[model samples]
Target chain A: MMSDNSDIDKYYDVVVVGAGPAGIGVGILLQKLGINHIILEKTSIGESFRKWPIETRFISPSFTGNFFKMPDLNAITPDTSPAFTLLTEHPTGEDYVEYLENLAKYYDLPIKTEVCVDTVQKKADSFVLTTNKGEYKSTYVIWAAGEYQYPKTNAFEGTHLCTHYSEVDSFSDLEGDEHIVIGAYESGFDAMVSLIRARKVVTLLDDGDYLNLVKSDSSYSLAPFTRDRIEYVADLFDYYTETKVTSVEFVNDTYLVKTANGQTFTSPQKPINCTGFASSLTLVKESFEFKNDYPLLNDFDESTKTSNLFLVGPQVKHKNALFCFIYKYRQRFAIVAEKIAKRMKVPSQAIEKAIQGYKDNNFYLTDLSCCDDECTC
Target chain B: MMSDNSDIDKYYDVVVVGAGPAGIGVGILLQKLGINHIILEKTSIGESFRKWPIETRFISPSFTGNFFKMPDLNAITPDTSPAFTLLTEHPTGEDYVEYLENLAKYYDLPIKTEVCVDTVQKKADSFVLTTNKGEYKSTYVIWAAGEYQYPKTNAFEGTHLCTHYSEVDSFSDLEGDEHIVIGAYESGFDAMVSLIRARKVVTLLDDGDYLNLVKSDSSYSLAPFTRDRIEYVADLFDYYTETKVTSVEFVNDTYLVKTANGQTFTSPQKPINCTGFASSLTLVKESFEFKNDYPLLNDFDESTKTSNLFLVGPQVKHKNALFCFIYKYRQRFAIVAEKIAKRMKVPSQAIEKAIQGYKDNNFYLTDLSCCDDECTC
Candidate 1:
């Protein structure tokens, strides 16, 4: 329905790129702030979540405690819950897409789907976005395009020989009795667990002991959801820690996964590359200065080099605090909105009321230093 | 290890006669207030949770977001989460039991297991309890005995002809291929979903059309977690709505289920009774005033008939509010603790601090009227 719309080439106060949770989140706040904004998407709303592996689920759990002040952790808005909308806790990609689509419809945010933004360039006082649809001019741009859809292809040589974890629709759809899984992060463990459940023999290669490392903060350790599955399937598969896969090659209908320690494993099919995803900022690398592979942002999450240009997704980080999860990054949506609203001169009373709503629910985390506390138990 | 304690024979200020999440929750607050309390469990701590059907999981989702004032809904304490402790959102009965056990140990709660309290007699400003192990005396009694273990047998005649949902360890352990499930609540739908997952044809008999009814409060409606699974399995099973089971008869090696509307279903195996659980207040029916099979309590959850006797579990219903969930029942734990502390003459500063913690996290829900609002979208 959105593909037929010719509104992609328009002028707006802010143009939010990508229609995932992050994009829709900012759009909702933008709507509340009464900002004339439009969300541009390459496909449809939450296309990345729709493209997630069918068996993959959010590590975060959601509960319908919106009225009680405990909104769903994965919810972009305060009153919504993926658990309530999709009726599941650990929502699959499709479940999440439904949630995003519902949020977009509920708020009636202006979003143009199937409009890909190929380039973003700051010209004078506006960001001239060059897209397949046309050139879009906006006073400010919120780069909310998430990272899950963009797989890290350059992690190893001959990477095309293996099936990226993000590419597989479902593990059940794969026709293989024995397979090799490269990388031992959450995705790697997820694929291994899925394969093990389907009565398949798996060999997992890990560069570190992520399974044994237990950290109170989710940013540093394996999620409890992954830990639970690993406990059940740990012994079912062969695991080699400290073994990093350096390259992969397909020869004679067999894929050879070569590791850094001069070890090679053979799989009947292509090895699953669960090495995780790359930053979506790779599309606009010239806009912001990189601080250790992460964007340099001000307190408002706007690019330091390019003022009025903001980033509101998982690629955001401040020192040691990793704002990669939905719960963490969703905090900045209100903050980013407030900053833009203040600059746009939206009434101070309205801005304060809108921002306070987020703060009241403990969703606004301005201080990143306090998040590193270890569990007392 | 607490079974070896000789303190079982001693007197106490409060005897919380249950070591599940409720008892542990009250115990933690009591410990903080320096109150003298001992948790008495009929079996081990969280035995009811341990007895739940293995395939059945918590309808509430658990997330570890305690520091930011959004504690896990399933957590008894502020800092703990079933997700972090058990590593799952919808933890199975065993997983929940482990979380409860961990809470008991972490807080060093004084709990006596395998000591069933048979009867209670108020004697001279004190309650004398006759247990299987010994007689115990206490000034106050908190009945934290949960309801899941006690299945309602007399809901229909010949109920013994069916298998209670809680009796089976897991659905996979069920030997029969064809089964008739009586009662279509959460437990009934849970059995149906599990049976369908296991490729077994199931016939679920419900007294009402609970599937289509959507309520804002989870206590009155089917949880989103259950709803999600029901969506996938609703078509797979034969669901008979508004069909109340009147009797179950076993003849010719076939179990026959008779409903109120002259409908009878037969299964080769015994019918599984998913007819929910009964309150554990049967032991103290003489203590509280009953209003249509419900206990009447004061503002502090103390019995109106007996001043010192209090209720702090799922059975505590007030007006239109049903405190049947961990999040709801957990709110009143502090209220009960505060009332008990004031009576025990504990330091007001300590009591206020202990209770304030619950309120700070929005765990102290003093008003029940606000819970009735349905979702607009």
Candidate 2:
């Protein structure tokens, strides 16, 4: 059910921001717990996913292993699989948006589209969410606003002069025969591959030796899907590892890229910046304490400084564990819901029954001790 | 340890046949339970995986989700991942062999190579396994000899006039510009894709409309990985759906393929047969009851006709469950080991402690009701 500004309810037990995988994931749990909550989407469901570059796809392959309790890697919930719904392994942005829309409809999630929450202020008893639609009062706030829509555009001196990887509609449609791409991460490689398939020559400037770096954690290393794609086009592109771009300068219809190691490369077109994304926490930074740019939260994922404010999604971090992927962040949904429900004094049996499936399928992870181990094989 | 013919053990508590994924998976669990067992192999460890055609790769993608309890799809054990060890999503035959070899070495599994078990006869309270090297006696036997090495060459009339898909060293090395691929499942599509990549023309004959058949279970339909690969070369092949090949005949130095639809196709070289494989159960058909070509087993996957005899790996089946993939069959490893361990009177505390990790990671699936549900989203 979608609500407009005129029909907006002033109070809700909990107000969830964003309607991407994270918000929808936790919202479903709250609904199952019989909590009075509403998910507020700034535009529509999966807007960030809908905005991905036309040629870009999920690096993690999706398989319908839900029956075996492994579920699809990109599925936001235990029972639903993106691969089974979309019938594709690497879903494109549009395809994923369709999946998100289907989940939102099938679960009958209460989401108010076009309701952008501008500021969240906590009063003595509750949190007040000031949105474009109307003011909403809630006992708790869950910050699930994802980070992809907000790209880190000011990473370098003249980064603004180059096209942000997120801004490009499609790499193949770019007007260039030869291109220079800065920040050789997943996004950078995706752009390179798309361009190469378009028969364009590319010079990729990698900030680090990520292509050769292998980590047990998928959050820190290249996905095997990306590595497989690179094998076919490895000979078509020029990759420079350990090369950090210092700045970009434009002079007389030509763009110059300078690196820290004292190398200059010239291109006739704007370089694509694939550095990274800034957390949406910037929107509500004051609500929680911070350490090293990440919000500090309690074991329940609630804001330490705020009484009832909770956090979920990719921005979640604990020590060295980075819960940036759907598979990682989805585990914390039940934890947050259980804590909030207990505080609300919901029936213990009901809470247990609601979370039983999550626990059975390894979705409710309370122990972080095993997260640091490397694969011995 | 690789045992030679001269040092063959004459008796054991449990004797596992065939050192493939199923053999290795069950062996590790038995070792953890402190059971006296030895895995016997006719040739070498991972011999079936090593014999896969050079162009064939695992259709299922591998990812290291061990921390989240969604271990790699191709991993036989919860603690190991093929993707993490080999750094590839879709491991080739040789790459998978390396992973299996690593597991065999890491677990120190007791395996004797070059010992062919030609026959098995049930005696009082024991079973005698007649092998090429010598005679062996055991209280129990686990059949893990996989199906890839046993091609179903007699599926259709005059099949000997065609080359089995497994016999090809490399699809690219075939000596023909035009080829007829006589099966349109995974192997058929795989052959067509490889031939198309090699710049050869292919005519694919599918027994059913498998290309359009979408089943909730992967065992009945094409995988998403194969679907994605087909997108690139969908227009490059001649696909005939609902066409069942009746026979392959040689006429005037040319191969003629006759189909059920009264259509005949001709090629200079022999047609490639990808009709699939016969179960290794054929090796011990008399020892077990058969229903629909699958062995009948009790709740513990033990033979219904023979006492203390168990089954593991792809050959194990329930009402509608097909344990054909590593991820599916690996779940039963603990089940089989636990039954044997309990019969052996291993302490209850030790049994529980040894199988706890498997139970925690979903390596033990005793319920089948949830397996039939389809993805709603």
Q: Which candidate number would show the highest TM-score if scored against the true structure?
A: 2
Query: In candidate 2, what are the lDDT values of residues B236-335, reduced to their tens digit?
Result: 9999999999989999999999989999999999899999988888888888999998999998999999888899988888988888888898999999
lDDT of each: 0.84, 0.89
Error of 1 at B29 (Å): 1.4
C-alpha lDDT of residue A224 in model 2: 89
lDDT of 2 at B246: 96
Scoring only the A-chain of each prediction against the true A-chain gives TM-scores of 0.97, 0.98
lDDT of 2 by residue, A209-284 (tens): 9899887788888888888888989899999999999999999999999999999999999998999888888889
Off by over 4 Å in 2: none
What class would a CAPRI assessor give candidate 2's docking? medium
Interface RMSD of 1: 2.5
Candidate 1, residues B1-377: lDDT per residue as tens digits? Answer: 37675776688999989888888899899888888878889989899888876788888877666654567788887667777776666788888888887877777888889989899889889999999888889999999988888888988999888899888788877997988999888888888999899999999898999887766677777887788788877578998899999999989988889999998898899899888787789999899998977899998999999999999989988887778889888988888998999998888888888877687666776766655555533
TM-score of 1: 0.87
